[model samples]
Target: MLLCDVVTTSASVAATRSRLAKVEAIAGLLRRAGDQVGTVVSYLAGAPAQGRIGAGWRTLVGLSVPPAQEPTLTVAAVDTTLGEVAVTSGKGSAARRTTLLEGLFGAATADEQRFLLRLLTGELRQGALEGVMLDAIAAAGDDTVGKQEVRRAFMLSGRLADTATAALTGGAAALAGFGLTLGRPIRPMLASPGESLAEALAMGECVVEYKLDGARIQVHKDGDDVHVYTRTLREITGAVPELVDLVRALDCRTAVLDGETLALDDGGRPRPFQETMSRFGATVERELPLHPYFFDCVHLDGTDLVDAPLRERNAALHRAVGDALVIPGVLAPTGEQAEQVLADALERGHEGVVVKDLDSAYQAGRRGKAWRKIKPVHTLDLVVLAAEWGHGRRTGYLSNLHLGARDPDGGPPVMVGKTFKGLTDELLAWQTTEFPTHETHRDDWAVHLRPRLVVEIALDGVQVSTRYPGGVALRFARVVRYRPDKQPADADTIDAVRALLPGAEAAGRG
Candidate 1:
């Protein structure tokens, strides 16, 4: 298929706000994709099949290649070129890559060049609109394949490109081949953020597990060959040999265990969030060894428990990994009892608790009410430093807020973090109207404001970070409400923000 056709179809998909219209447009593209269906889907999903080719705006901006007048590049050809560009490296590799990019860009028409730039630089992001694309893949199946089946297949495979090809090709039959496979990482099940213990307990009869502040890991063991994957499905098998060794020692011949791994302090409390994250990279650290704690067993000794109830899965988990390694939790607790569990988790220096419905099956890659995370809401009265103009659906709104904590010495507020989360339409409208009144300066990206307005912000916690002037950054911060009653002087101090870092006595995990 011509690259121009796919590009135009992507534009059509992006131009529409209606879900049905987006699905139909993508379905049409899928129908016409033929053998290049995978490549087309990946591109529209704003990911290259080659994945993160060492090219960026700085590398491409200098290219002076003239655009071709007529459309002639094919999707397959572009994919092949990008694949080649990704692997080009070593001595004088920069020039070699530029030559290749220039050749590819030189052949493309002006419109195709624009699309290629968007595709290469990682700007054309439609993956966030992935639900519509999944629907489109099912729709293109001519009613032979159901939406749930497609989603299941995608979740199991952890690759939308593969899902697209399967759904568009042999319909349900192709997707049926996708199942629990050892060594291949499936997307791990995610927990929905819970409001409070009482509210979460009201959802259903549930098990509450201590939500440890650690990295999510999915361990697969096929005989001696054990692989550990992150929540995003990247294998860190080599970096975390302790995890591999621990899983290999399991009595089961083959198993897929979902859990969290973290580094620990001398007191046996979990280490800071950054220290734990450090173990997730390519390099193994002897000083920062990661300890594994398995929670859910997906497959064990050839028995697939993915479709089983949580009660059955927990039994399987205990049978496979033993109770010593399993995450501590209570099954089917009352509301008051669940609150006790949350308090216990907090007192132990853990993040919070996750209330999981006992009867719900493991819904991989989906965040629903099956499992709900109840963490402490850490709020800070932070001064609004600036606001970035929004994009896409939030185009006209002043969306992302730059937050600062009051410097105790009183020089200036220290910039801590930025967040656009939890803002309602009413809040966005209010920001647009109210922010300009406090404006000190303006830039193309954001409107700078006088540090007079104090906004109440809720965060998961603070982590050690060099990105902020305060040497700490807010994790998962969102607007609680505007603290119009408070002044900048009344805002939380930078010392207060730093004290929230995990491992500090004043951090208050509970």
Candidate 2:
């Protein structure tokens, strides 16, 4: 398939808000992708197959190469070229990389050039994200692979490229082949936000576990060798020797433990989110040790209990690890007991409690109503669009913050409201110095950014508003903290914000 063919499909996907339309258009493209299905799917995923070809926004914009008069670049050829660019590094490699980029962009037509630029800069928002692409992949396979089958494969494998290839080639059998590998990390199951403890208790017969504010870590153990992965599935075993040692000491020979890791203060209270996240450095930092709190054990002594109910998994987890590692929870609790659990968690400086249905199996990569997280205060992970300069005593610092929610349709983040609240003088100095690094342009009032930084914003509620494109605005919004561990893609979407309106039930399912 030609690169222009994929580019045209991407444009069509970006032009519509209808999810079925997006899925069908991409499914049509996948039908014609032939042997280059993996390459073409990765492109539609808003990145090259090799990932990060050493190109930046400025470098992409600086190119003066004219577009090709006709479509000539093939999908396979483009994939191979970017693969080479990903390996182009060392002394004097900048000039060599520039030459390769210039040649590639020089060969692309106008529309193809735009698509390439957006893809390289990680801004190719065509709504072909994992969820939509999963549907598309299922659709491309003659409907032989169901949605749940494809999701299971993708979540366990953690790569859309390989999942797509497997679904298209070997059908359902191939997808089923994707299972828990010893060293490989699967996507962690997440909890949906609940309006209140009372609301969550009414859902089902549940176990309410203490929800801690910490980084999600998945530890896989095979004999003495243990590997640690973040929620994004990036491996960081070497940086967390304590966690590795803890997992290595597990009684079971081989196990996959899903848990949260965070640094704690002297009083045993959880530290700030940034303080805990800062411990995940490239090198080991023993001063700030991260404690792992296991909630679910997918694999224990070769039992393969992932498909088992949470009640069974919790029992297995308790048997595998000591009480210090297993998170605190009450099985089959009354409403008052569940509320007390939430109170105890908050008293320990934890986030809240997750009322989890005990019978729900481990459904990775999807947030169902089986688990509901209820916090005393409502919080949303929003993106920082811009920061305005401060005045008076706060002069010379970026004070007021412009916040935005992620667009579900894969467009730029929509501005919901602005807040200068909850920022200390120290934070002011930090953003004033750090915000410039992500600046795209600067006006007299605020420094426009690339919408990359994710901030956890605590808001009272949202109201209907015509000021923002999303038709809603945050009420009494304040900065909780900067979520350095999260990415812009991980921020809460506009649909979630709309769910927080006065009349809405829950913020989101996932």
Candidate 3:
């Protein structure tokens, strides 16, 4: 198929507000994409099949090319050319990459050029994400495949491209054949925030575990081979050699453990989140050693525990890691007991406690209500929409941040409030250097960004407001830390922010 056809379908998908219409358009395109299923799926979801290729906005915006009078570029041809551009490296590679991009863009039509520019710069604003694309993939199966089956296959495989290909070529039965492997990583389960400890216990018997303020990791061990992956499934085995050695010391031959990893101080307490992240993102040096605490085991001793209940999984975790590394927890605690658990966690310099349903199975990649997190203070993950220039002693820096919450209906983020608090000198210097790289437009006072950076913010509460489109604003907001582990899609929704309103509980239950 021609690149213009895919570009035209993407335009139609972005123009319509109805999700059903978007799904229908994508399903029709998927039916037509015979051998280019991988490329088509990746482009429709606003990403490249080749992944990040060291290309940035600074490199692409400098080239100018004339448009072709006719559409002659094929999808496979573009994919191959991008693969070439990605692999080009070393001396004099920059000039060669620019020449290659110029030739490709010059051959594309005007609309095709727009699509390519957006796709390369990671600014494709189409409303279709992986969730909507999964629905479209099922729709293209002509009722031979179910939506839930496709979702499960996607969660296990950790790749939408592979799941779509399986459903398209081998039907539903082939898609159902996907299972947990020892070395491969599956999507990790997530949690939702509860209003209070009493409310969390109201759900019935539960297991409350301390929520550590650290990076989420999934460790897989098979005999002498060990691999570690982040929550987003990026392998960091080489950077974290200490963790590799630690997992190899376990008793089980093959296992998959889900938990948190952090660096500790001399007093055996957790360090600041920024200090831990500094070590997490480093690749060359080994300055800080990280420690792991196992909470749940998904696979152990050649058996998959994903289908088992939480009680069974915890037992497996204890047998695998023993009492020294197991997270502290209590079973079926009362309201007062749960409060005491939270207090103990805070006293030990931990985040909070996660109340989990005792009989609930591990729902990978889905943020269901089976698990709820309770923290001492309320915090929200919000996007940076814009930043204003600093004043006085902070002159010549990007100081104040305009924050927005994600829209639940797949729309753009809604503005909530702004904050300049909780920023250190290092953070201020880093923002001044990094904010302009994501700049979409600029003015005299502030420079607007692409809403890509996610930051965790601590707030007092929420109040009714007519200034913002969400009808709510944050009270006494301040920054806690920047979340490089999370994406913009992972930000809290506008409705989640409004749930902190004074009378929101009564309105919610009614």
Candidate 4:
């Protein structure tokens, strides 16, 4: 199939708001993809099969190539070209890459050029992210392959491209063959924010675990060979050799442990999040010795516990790690008990407690209601939509963040409000350097960015508003911190923000 056909389908998907229409368009493309299913799916999902190629807005802005008068670029040809561009590096590689890109873009049509630009810069905001693409894949798969099976395979493999290829070629049997590989990283299970301890406990009997203010680490261990990954699945095995040592000393031979790691002060109290981050981010040599706290074990002793209940996973974790490394948790706690757990965590300089359903299975990559995190302050994980140039003493820096809440129905983020508060000089400098890399477009006052950066914003409440698309705005919003651990898909939805509004329940019923 031609690359133009895939690009045209993506355009149609973006133009329509109807999920069914988007699915149909994508499903048709997948059926026509034939042998190029993997590359086609990857492109339609707004990513290159070759991944990040070091190309940025700076390289593409000034270098414009004349468009081709005809649509003749094949999907396999584009994929091969991108692969060449990605592998080109070292001395004189920049000039070589630019020449390759110029040739490729010059051969593409105008619409194809726009599509290539978006795909390269990672700004293809068509509202058809991995979740929607997964649905479309299921729709296009053979009748033997169930949607649940496809989802499970995708979660286990951590690559939609691989899943799509398997589903297309080998059907359900190939997809079902995907299992918890010892070295591969599976998506971490996520938690939604709980309104209160009472509200969280009202669900059912819960296991209240301390929510540590540290970097999330998923350790995959097979004897001495250990690999560690961040929440976003970036491997950091070499940065922290201490963590590798700790995992190597574990009782189990092969295990996948999910937990947090942080630097603790001399008094055994958890250090500031920034201090912990500094330790984790260190590359040359590790200064501080970081500690690992194991909470859940997804796999142990060659057995996969992802299908097992939380109770079983917790037991497996205890059996694998020493008591000192185990995260503290209480089973079937009452409302008062849950509150005490939260208080204890806060007193220990921790974030709060995560109340989890005792019988819930670990649903990787799904932020279900089974686990709820209760923090002290009311905070929302919002996407950074844009930023304005600073003034006064803050000149030349990006300040005044424009925040948006995620749409519940997989649409673009609904702009909630803007804030210039809670930013330190360090954060301002970082934003100034970083925001432009993610820039989609810019005007005189502000530079719009791809909705990718997730920021935890502390807010007093939500008020009905006409200024924003969500019909509600954040009141007294201020940045708590930049959540490098989260993605825009993990941001709090508009309905979650609406739940904070006064009389929200009554309004919903009405």
Candidate 5:
């Protein structure tokens, strides 16, 4: 019920590197939150607050200031209390927060400024406090809940404070049964192929589908109403009216489909991912036509097909969406055929291929070998060991991420490179709020973080380097996406890095 309670939980979660544990701690806190202010502060200050949670917090707090300037402003505010003032100007970094803090709080002692900054940054360093909140919820509930159920409720409800109120007044099941909803949008299943066809086959006998590189989207259509959501689950229905019309034209009455939406260039080919996302912006050409290549059907009519096996769901998808809106697939009983499809898809300028296990059901929020993504063997699964603070629009948040690979003898990771590309505005906001929790220590310029987050790094090539610790850095590194399935320990190591070198494999596993 106290601010200290919320602050303590945030401190504990931030101090740890285990995401699962951190999530559990936060979920527990949400269930027990009795103090409205405490619940609000804890959720806003916690780590991994991205996507729905971060957006919802920003909306509620009315922090009109862009995420880039938040750290400076928050830090400076430590000396003074700036009540309800909208940040109007951006002055890079050094001058911005100092000016705002001084103006907002007037003149304050140096120590007072420092103290205020700590609170503004949400680094209260409290411990096991979130669990107390969770206990409060469990105590008030009619029935206990699984951690997964708690997480699902927390995520689906959008705001922890609102959801906590619901849970306390009724029960968790009341919140959990909030009905079919949207959260962070369904992400596409990914695959990493084994070196040989036999090896790929040994992993699993899977149905191989054409992997399109267009924008990953989920279409929700009921009667003539159509809603389009990006992979991150932001509603973009108004942004693509043409696509809405296309969905409305479909014969199906109600359906939820997973697909790729793309923009066609003058040549009539599916445009690049960049071009497709460009249409999502406010200033982009509105008349640009977009088409969807639906791959999986999770719901049709009134039936929820999420529980059905992929083979059955694929059939349902065909019957509901028809072939025109769907990407054609290859029923491969053997890995050799899948290899052929992979080559064909790549030759056609597609990304690669997605290999789905026929018998596997849709496993939401879980990445297993059941759904393997076989991209070109060229890209590296790099870990985000550290990140540098951004400037301008990206200031405060660790916009530039430092990548690392496994060690030669299974030791600590070696730094490979850094990247500032392929980030969305939503992603930037999420990173700004979430990254600080993972900070191991900070310098005047950059923050050294515990090597825990793994990201799939797509690059032009691996080049020889003298600047980085790994002896090589990723050339033109860009984020393919965050690999939530990956653990920091599973991230590519220095041994893997050395193996990527010329003739290293023949010598050993680096």
Candidate 6:
């Protein structure tokens, strides 16, 4: 495929604000990819490659030569290369990396920059495409024998580029034997909320654990080998060597555990959420140490616990790490007990509590009622009436969305907030494809979609603001989910939304 293929697909996907469309386009190109190496090279060389580390990046070059070739032969080789094009080239902090990218890839848009960043950062917003790649390998091989060979090569190599190359040169067995990478759990998952403990219990009798105020992480260890990753799968192995050392000392020979990392306060309890985040980046004080609190075991001693029940996984978790590495607290007998724990946690300055169902299986990348998060009174039901193009993982999808509440007097729905969080690739695609029918108007930056699509929104707090027509803004707004059972006219009104405001019941109800 030509570089134009990626460019055109990117433009169309961006125009429509659809993640699925962009992913499908990329997948289609990969399927028809005759010269896979050349295709990757071309895509990376042009528009997609000229941004910061996490966004869409240009195709990689220099692989044709020996791996030990001079630095100039590598894609990041020349000082003139885009990544090397310093953001503050003779300028200061005001000149963003985006500005540098625009200077180099004049044709690329903000959306394009976002895509390149994900590629470079290996965030790969396109989920399950690796599985598709495997299928493509099977189809591209000479015969069943050749396909099997390619699969095996991929399984052994454990790297994407190597897997693709093996299929092109070796065969399918290379792909089939593709093993799960370290720090990548077989049943990774996100959480969804239930209306209350009763709704959660309806699923089954579950062991509820208090959600801690910490960073979500996955830890992988094999004998002396150890690695750790964020929820998005970015390797932060260098950030917390203490965790690596702790997991290495565990009894299990090979184990994959899910948990949280936190920065403790002087009292030896968790600190603020922002403080935990600050521990990231290159310059965090290592001696201070981010402590990990293990919870679930996805893989233990060469056995896959992905399909196992939460109870089984928990049992495995205890056996693998013992009590030393797991989070300090244990199971609560009831919601009242859980509430007491939550109160104690908040008193210690923790954000809130997370309640988990004991029998729930790990559902990768899906947020459902299985694992519910309860923060302070900080969530809302808002409507999406308009959307704007987004960069990075959401470049082609309606990444940033405009939210609103119904009008009490049957007037236009009032705008409440805008958000890009609480969304998956699947949700992006669904909204992009479905939002158009509700389109009322369009501007270069945003589409004024018709009033519909009620989505529950989680918020940090309410603040008065003049920017929004509603005279307020929801801080840290995120989509909870599409309340499909709702109607546009049935959405909560601005009056109702104001009810969530503090100490203004008279004004809120008015």
lDDT of 5 by residue, 82-144 (tens): 321233334553345445544543333333333333444433333333333443344444565
Q: List where candidate 2 sits over 4 angstroms from the true fold.
A: 506-510
RMSD of each: 12.4, 2.1, 1.6, 1.9, 9.8, 13.7
Order the numbered candidates by TM-score, best leading. 3, 2, 4, 1, 5, 6
lDDT of 4 by residue, 87-144 (tens): 9999998998899899889889999999999898877777677778888888888998
Clashing pairs in 3: none
> lDDT (CA) for every model shown?
0.83, 0.88, 0.88, 0.88, 0.60, 0.60
Q: TM-scores across all candidates?
A: 0.76, 0.96, 0.96, 0.95, 0.62, 0.55
Worst-scoring 10-residue span by lDDT in model 6: 61-70
Task: Please identify model 5 stretches exceeding 4 Å from their true place.
Answer: 18-32, 35-143, 151-172, 181-200, 203-205, 266-269, 283-287, 380-456, 459-510
Candidates 3 and 4 compared by lDDT, better number = 3
Q: Any residue pairs clashing in model 1, and if so which? A: none
RMSD of 6: 13.7
Better of 4 and 5 by TM-score: 4
Per-residue lDDT for 1-510 in model 2, tens only? Answer: 999999999989989989899999999999899889988889898888888788776877898899999999998888877888789889978888788888999899999999988888877878887788999999998557999899988888888988999999889999999998889899889887887888888878889999998999999999999999988888888888989988888888989999998888999888888887777765644678888999999998877888899999999999889777899879999878887898899889998999888889998866668888989899999999999999999989998999999886666798999999999888999999999988889999899988889999999999999998889999999999998777777888898899899867633442
Candidate 3 weakest ten by summed lDDT: 52-61
Candidate 2 TM-score over all chains jointly: 0.96
3-48, model 1: which lDDT tens digit per residue? 9998788777666546677788888889999989999889887778
lDDT accuracy of residue 404 in candidate 6: 91
Model 4: which residue pairs collide? none
Where is model 2 poorest over a 10-residue stretch in terms of lDDT? 501-510
